[model samples]
Target: MSPPKLVFYVTVVVFAGVVIFTRDLLYLVRTETRYGQLDQYDHAVRNKHHMDQANLKILRAKAGLVHDENNIELNLTLRFQVNGGENEVRQKLKYVDKTVKTSKKEAASQGEITFETPSLLTLFTTWSGKGDVNARTHNFTLRNWARLKPEVNPVLFIDDGYDATVAQRLGWKTHRIPKSSINGLPVLKDMFKVIKDTYKSTFYGYANSDILFTSNLVETLVHVYYDSFYSDNTTLVTGMRTNIVNLTEEEFSTQTTLLNAVSTRGQLYMTSAEDYFIYAAEYSWSDMPEFVVGLIAYDNWLVLNSRYREDHVIDASRTVTAAHHTVREPDYQSHFRENAQYNKVLFRKMMQFHVEPPYEKGFTNCIDKYTEFVDKKIEIRSRKLEDPCLF
Candidate 1:
């Protein structure tokens, strides 16, 4: 309680704060400084610096590899649609049957041909809203993803009321699931099962249809495949997405051109969240709750649960550019309001219990930042670090 003692304590506290802040500042400087030419978008450039910094920290966390710390190991395997009219469903079924046969023949020709599935499969659930932009974005996305990686098969699952003719033309396996709904969200648990049973790939990825991807997405997946630290099947992959509006189909004629466009114009927003999810096909999800896509907290809960279950969940923002091409937000209808309510209730439980996923240690905010939970509570600085050093 003496004056001298008080002064000494304050000095020590200030010095410690200065040390932490200065160290963090140096880290940002090293990672955010761009070596290449800047772009026309100033905000985008600044945002990209923050993004690149966060991504660098994430990549550096797992022994200098991109990974999240989770103890479980499921084996990384492969095997691998949605809505539309009943006719679209029928077309999808026919396509699936034909593709399965063709895949068998291809495997047989390669000699042993023991496994009946491919290495990877990607699924996109979307409804082409009443606009050319959405449809055009879908066209570019499907086309780009179809040829994104030759080894990985991509399928388009369309919701009812939307047409899949364009997708069919792109040679993507287009399927329409039954229009059953829970909370106005198409039942995805069963839908996921159907795709898994049919394609039987080693890995399965679910991405929004409006999200444009380059070849780097597949190459990043390949990087995950080769990662020795979290190479096991129990790994779940997701990443921060850059939002780029009004990108035309012609801009994406090739991966090189598309990536260049994204680099120059893509607005670097939405850090530490996910737009795409790629995971081992064998991971169990029979109990996944009903979640309408594009609604708030649906994706957040997935990250929380994955962390709770000790699965290796990674943010591959640095390695993959999962670009969101549309500018318009979804209409807020009564049903959407209901979904938001469900999200609120669910998130409350997630926050109350303070579910700590592996490797995260004390952090609980799964929305953004690789934050550290100190004193069993989230501090202001916890939110400040774009990529807080886990050490």
Candidate 2:
């Protein structure tokens, strides 16, 4: 039990201790390797899930199932992919195109869409009965108006018991004028009241039955409607007529023939002769006098009243070419007619009752502004008032 026995026992104990420590180290290494592999697999699965979500979004956008905001972003991304030579993205865009066409067709078939446009302006007139020189002239006028765009609605207010065969044939709306008149002539204010009540239009116009307008009439109104100057105010648009003597029905058969005749034979009338009046829907005719149409003083009085109200009184002479067809020279002495005198008397009465003393003269010069074509575009220019009566 001396030195030799003690050494052998110590060596055995040391070797056993070394073996146990080595086995424990190997176990620790194996556990760490398994955990690392599991972490790598989880990361790969998470990346695959993120990629699937992105692909679904793109597919939804291509199918037009995404909201507009998302579609916008998707469109930009797809466009980029298209530009980057991605043939698959290009095919997706084509599919989206086909889907859009199908969707539109489905909506249309279901009555979910409409393409009908509403009329923007209503042009109206009153004329004498058939079987007269006036009737022939009115026929030409109505036909000329029928050639205008559908946006301009043409209506003929037939005098009570008068035939509207010509207007009806031209597809114009026909209605009987109220029996209210002075000396068998329809009152201007009453006619306007009827027009306002019966029709829905952005603008209303009353042209003399003999007046022929070019397509510029509609173009001028469109410009005025969008003009910022008239945005906050009611407007009264009037212009001088171009008189063409003995303008035959043959001469007015087509717009081109009519314009050629006008360019050669037409003479611009004096500023005092305003044959047509166009006013905005917001214009008030409540205080207008019961002056009969086709009479003197009434048109003048209207211009004066519009100016008095601080409305936008625009002289459209430069833009609108209103052709007045005259079979014979107008009788200057017609101012002495009974209806003319009646209008004058009515004007005096309206001035006495409604207007202040030192009444302003009612004329084209009283207009606050005038329209003209600048570089082929309509422009509103302030008119310089040289007449003291206008101020």
The per-model lDDT (C-alpha) reads 0.51, 0.64
What are the models' TM-scores?
0.59, 0.66
Per-residue C-alpha lDDT of model 1 across residues 1-391, encoded as one tens digit per residue: 9999999999999999898778667644543442111222434433543556666354233211222222111122222211221111110100011111223235323321222344444555655343545556666677777764334567766656667776677667766754445444554556576677777665777777678765445444544543443434577777666666677666677655666566656655433235777777777776566665645555656676776666766666555667777755323232365545664355555552332212122122232322121222111121332333232
Q: Which stretches of candidate 2 lie over 4 Å from their true place?
A: 1-117, 352-360
Residue 311 lDDT in candidate 2 = 80
Model 2 clashing residue pairs (backbone): none
What tens digits encode model 2's per-residue C-alpha lDDT throughout 265-330?
565565556788899887888888787876776787888887777788888877676888877766
